[model samples]
Target: MGKNQKKKSNKRFWWVLISVIIIVGVGSSLFFFNFFGIGIDALNNSDTAGSVEQKDLSKKEEEKINQVRSTVGESHQDLGDFVASTHEFYNDTTGYGGINNLDWEEQKNKSEQVIMEIEKLTLDVSDESLKQDLQSILNVSQQAIEEEEAEDVRSLHRYFHDLDIALNDYQSYDRIWNVTETLKEVR
Candidate 1:
């Protein structure tokens, strides 16, 4: 190629490269600013925008809610204690110590006591959903108690699984209640 032709071609390549770079840089900056600027604005305006107004609870309603909370909290604690005790009993019977050391009558009595406590809690619970959950747990525990032999360990495991799920639900409810209470205080 001639020297003049080569110089012209190099100039054209440089121009095209610079043009592409400028286009890409502009596109990137536009995207960055548009996306993040809206995000920051939304964060700043969150309290005012699309906020739900929570009305203050009436005296009677407040008392009822507090009573429900107390009952549920107490029941949750009782269930937790029962679970811990049962777990210890399970570990002692099934661990290296072996099932031979298990006291069947003692286990039966404990199961009866838990069933009685759960029945009372179920009656006291005004929330139908919570009442149903307690009833379900109680039914499962009753089934576990009726099993004739410890050889079928699956029943025991099923009872524990249901108990764990109930405990998690209770904990989640407690956390939600706490968060709402905190928000009320903030307002």
Candidate 2:
């Protein structure tokens, strides 16, 4: 090829590369605060009263449940808020191409499943609420494995499955967190 032709081709290649980098950077960075909201807060809260033990079995378990429950709530809030707002941003920025991506529809189904799990996690108006609550939250955690980003679906599924195994280590239907909930109540 001629020298001038080679120079023009190189310029075009660099321009395309720069454009891709700018688009990806802008897309990924805009969601940083939203993505890490609950994660950062719960880490900061780890040293609070909820982490300590209590004298009574019932109270100690209750406190532990409360701690885990609070963390779960924060995570749900962070993800829910971000997802609810994303459609508006996508509508404004993507000019319909983004709407065509079937990934969003799959994500929508996963989020709905989590919402159903959360619905089950609420109080049952009974005195023995902790048992039901723990069971519900365990189900919710399983649902969360399904709710992960599409890019990591299989990996997350396997990871959370392992988490499930670890949680159920005592040969019971209930889990370590079930015992932990006894602490949260006592605290």
lDDT to native, each model: 0.48, 0.39
lDDT of 2 at 8: 100
TM-score of each: 0.35, 0.21
- When summed lDDT is taken over every stretch of 10 residues in candidate 1, the lowest stretch is 173-182
Worst 10 residues of 2 by lDDT: 166-175
Per-residue lDDT tens digits for candidate 1, residues 1-187, read 9999999999999999999999999999779756443333334432122223324445554444555545543466655455555545554444332332346676566567767877765554554555555565566557657874544232343343334333322231121111122122222
The runs of at least 3 residues in candidate 2 whose Cα sits more than 4 Å from the true structure, single-residue gaps closed, are: 1-102, 122-159, 167-187
Best by lDDT: 1
Query: What digit string (tens of lDDT, one per residue) describes model 2 on residues 58-149?
Result: 54553554554454434444333332343233323222222223255554455455446445533332323334434544454455455543
Q: Give the TM-score of candidate 2.
A: 0.21
Model 2, residue 160: C-alpha shift (Å): 3.2
| lDDT value for model 2 | 0.39
